[model samples]
Target: MQTILSRVLKNSTFITSIISILLGILVGAIMMIMAGYDPILAYNALFASALLQPYDLGETIRTITPLILIGLAVALAFRTGLFNIGVEGQVIVGQLVAVIIGLKLGLPPVLHAVVAIIGGGLAGALWAAVPGLLKAIRGVHEVIVSIMMNFIALNLSNVLIRRWLAQGTDSTPEIPESASIQMDFLSQLFGGARVHVGIFIALVAAFIMYYLLWKTKLGYELRAVGYNPLASEYAGMSVKRNILLSMMISGSFAGIAGAAELLGTSGYQSIQATFTGIGFDGIAVALLGANTPIGVILASILFGVLTYGGGNMQFEAGVPFEVIRVVFAAIILFVAANISGPLVNLFSKRRRDKHRARHLD
Candidate 1:
């Protein structure tokens, strides 16, 4: 038992992530005490509201649905050593295309939904492809391009929504029933919580991402390139192609998230002056999960629970929701700090040098 425990504790990444979470919670509790609130009562109310009731549970699952896909999008890019900040842009364009297809295309019920989902994925892929192409061909950094693409996608989407789709309105028409992904039986089971079939789609996507990254030839190439692009190129792999393909694949996952949102959650495209922040949250989720598919699911669940339950903390315990946000930011910060090997090494070096110089003197 001691040996087993030792081995388990030796996994630095796992230990770091767990410690970060605990420390974040500890900080939150301290803040609550300082603010004259009972931390235990607030936490209890949060979990109770999020998990103790069927309706809230269903909403939690619904929120987790898109997060799963978004996390996967960011995770895949990280696995391939590509920073896909364009996921937000991909999601925006994906929604725009999915809504348009859902409104304009007439088809059978199942087919209509399928087409909308596919359109969203393709749109995302196309949007992400531009940055990937530039990065591969011109040595441009993906982060810069994707960040700019986010603004472009946002403004373009707003224009399309106002001028073409809604006739000067800020939102588009609700999609037809044929394009809806809601499962009546599932919703009824969850006490009319508006959960949809997209959960299954998200699960399948997770499985596929796992299989593609760890079990197949293409997965091997992507991982290899991520490990060492120069070595991969020397071994006959096309670095440029892999770079582009990985970004496109990542974008497609983000696009599917957008499709799931429109078909099951929102049902219409609204002109947004601000980002939804789901794509950005995905970056945190991917990092928190250590860029693994299964990890992403767990991390997404953690985030989803907090998101759905924060309101209850406010209502039942008189704790402000901003406290929850601080806890979240702290978790990310600690996780980053723990994983920063250079920072740790630098401190260790300074300590050693100071001790050695004192001995010499």
Candidate 2:
């Protein structure tokens, strides 16, 4: 454990993230003081409510489950030099497909859940393939195509759910027991906080992503293409194929995130007036985690804590939940600025100067 902690501390990205988080907290405190609130009390209440109880901790984990998957989705794209902003759309489509399969399929328990989850992922991949095709074949930018696809996915999903599954209802049918990811023992342990098998699925997905990106030939090609399409093509790599594959893989993870949410938490797809903000939230997680698999998981946990604890902070300390959001925003902004790189450079320069001075003396 100590070795792991030491390595994490030594990682420049991780150190920078810590600095950003501390600065964010400091900003939050300033805001709270300006508004006549007690920052310490509010933060204490947040932590207490989020960690001091089994239920709270369980709820935080449950919230984290899908975020971890979504974070992985975005992080994978980041590593491969793709901004898969369409993950929102991919997740929506995945949710719709998972609900349809869960409601209609009649397989055995474990098998049914597996099928539904995979079905959702497949749906997301297909949905993402459109933008991928456009980008790969037509030389169109993915950001534009993916953003447009998000609107299409939202409205198209609404239409499909209403016409095919709902047929005059406001929501799709509840997921059958066969397709539910909920585990009785886990639920019991958490006092019915709705944690499920999705966490394990998310962790496994992270491991798969890590292994695929760092340990496989295909991973090398994908990353190589992302690093320099011209060089990769000169090396006989198929840039277009890698681009399409990367988007599809990213979308698959997002879709799995959607399926996990429905199967493990919500159990049904309601008519959405808006895209679930969770997809956009993944961008922050990816940034904060430095687009690494382990970073995504750790970042998801931090986000979950802040998100779940915000309400308690509001109630106990009379601070608005929006303040917590502000802190999150601040952290993301700082991370985006790449503050850690500059800080590291400054520290290195200072060390060099000190060494030169000592040698001269």
Candidate 3:
């Protein structure tokens, strides 16, 4: 049992993630106490609200639908040694494109939905390609370009929506039923919650990403370039092409997240006063998950639970909902600290020294 425990603890990344979560919870409890709230009661309410009811569970799953895709997007980019700060822009562009296609295209129900979703993915890929191309060709920093593109995408989406699709209000017309991703059976199963078939789509996407990154030659090239661009280039790989490909792929995942939101839930694109923070939250998700596909899925679930349950905490315990965000922020900070490796190493060294002394005796 001791050997098994030590072996499990030796996984520094897992240990770090777990420790970060526990520490974040501790910090949250301390804050709750300082604020004159019972931390245990607040947390109990949160968990009860989120998991003890079918409706809230469905909503939690729905919320994580986009988060899963966005987390995967950021993780993919990180694995390729790129930071895709423009997932927000890509999502905006993709949502606009999806709405346009759903409104304009007339086809069979399944075909129409499929085409609109694909259009959204393509738009995101194209939008991200610009930054990738600039980074590859002109040596422009991707972070700067991506951030600027986010602003541009926001403005452009508003302009296009108003000019072409906006109804009496700031949002586009409701998408046709044919293009909707909602399934009546799924909703019924979840006690009439608005959760849709998009959750399954997200699962499939995660599997696809895992396969693409781990099983394919193209993925190998991309990973190689990410590991060492100079070495990859010396080995006759096209670093520029791989960079562009990585951004496009990453953008596609974010774009699909937008499509899922529109077709599965919102059914229309609204002009936003501010960028939706899903893309930004995705950064934390990726970090917490250690940039792996499976890790992203699990991290998305944790975020989903916290976000969906926060309202209940406020309602039932009078705790501020923003406390959830604070906990999430603390988790991100600890994960970024990367302190688990040294702790694990120290423990392993002590164990080795003790074993040596026993042998000498």
Candidate 4:
């Protein structure tokens, strides 16, 4: 029975997540009907708007880009037993550096964009390194330090955007032509939505992250350290170094997330009325995707579709968009709590059985 339960659990992660999603949608529909909205109309409108229209679909993909990057960032860190809650801060710092480089440099368009992106990644790495160093060297709690750093980065970004980067108006100066990406091609293809090359970049990054985590020596050491730091240490691996490296790499991915948002989507540095909650959402994505690069990407796209569809749901049926967020939260909680462990175990057992059969043959 225990083995069967473990096998069931191993198969349940994806199935559980899917069930949670369906349950959430059903509940959302009930709520919408109770609120005097036509649930079917809202849901259909959402699906149509997110999928049927080219521009709408493109926008959905564009929204997915940053989510994929940040989701992977969170997953990478989580795999190594590090809770990096400072992705928000790392993203802000990266955006600042990208903006600065985009505005100041007089290089060619491609070169300017590349340099700015690299600069943003470096800035994020530096910011993440702080908490990493503290945790590794001083035995401080990374969760606390990362959370504090998030607050600092939030305040710092707001101040910098309003004071140093603002144009004659409140927002920062528009990025120069040389630094701007060519979204026109995507717009034309998608009927005027702002989809860009960033989506391709995200896909490439996902593959790169997969290779790094599954096929590389560093990845093995990182996972070992995460699973059992004492054992890793006994194996002659430097746990501190791996921790720092993981954090820095995680931050760099988040930096790319910010760059995708600022450079590819917004095209300028600006402060939001409230801190964007993408960092927190990344946690949900990571968990649902089972902390794998492929899973993260797919989960992020699922979220992107839901969000994009939610807007039309509101427009067509007058259902509040906040309800969509509620549904997403419920789904995430249920999937995280009841699914992953059993699913992984089942897969592991199946793989082991296969290996034994092959060897015997």
Best candidate according to TM-score:
3
Reference-based lDDT, each prediction: 0.89, 0.90, 0.90, 0.84
Candidate order by lDDT, decreasing, is: 3, 2, 1, 4
Candidate 4's residue-wise lDDT over 1-361, tens digit each?
5567656655546667777788778888888878888888888888888988898999898888888988988999999989988898888888888888888788997888888778888888888898999989998988899889888888887788888888656677878867766467788999888887778877887898889989999999999999999999999999999999999999998888887678887888777665688888888888888898888988998899989889878877778999889888878877767745555667777878987999999
Candidates 1 and 3, the one with greater TM-score: 3
RMSD (Å) of each candidate, 1 decimal: 4.7, 2.7, 1.4, 5.3
Clashes of 2: 0
62-163 per-residue lDDT for model 3 (tens digits): 999999999998999999999999999998888989999899888789888888889989988999999999999998989999999999999999998888
Q: Which stretches of candidate 3 lie over 4 Å from their true place?
A: 1-7
Q: Over the stretch 1-361, how does candidate 2's per-residue lDDT look in tens digits? A: 5445444544658887888999998999999999999999999999899988888888999989989999999998888888888999999999988988898889999999999999999988888888888888998988899999999999988888888888589888888899999999998898778999999999999999999999999999989988999999999999899999998999999999999889999899888888878999999999999999999999999999999999889889999999988999999998888777765566666667887999999
User: What C-alpha lDDT, on a 0 to 100 scale, does residue 295 get in candidate 4?
Assistant: 86
The TM-score of candidate 4 is: 0.90
lDDT: which is higher, 1 or 2? 2
After superposition, the stretches of candidate 1 with alpha carbons farther than 4 Å from their true spots are 1-3, 339-361
Q: Which residues of candidate 2, in runs, are more than 4 Å off?
A: 1-11
lDDT of 1 at 271: 91
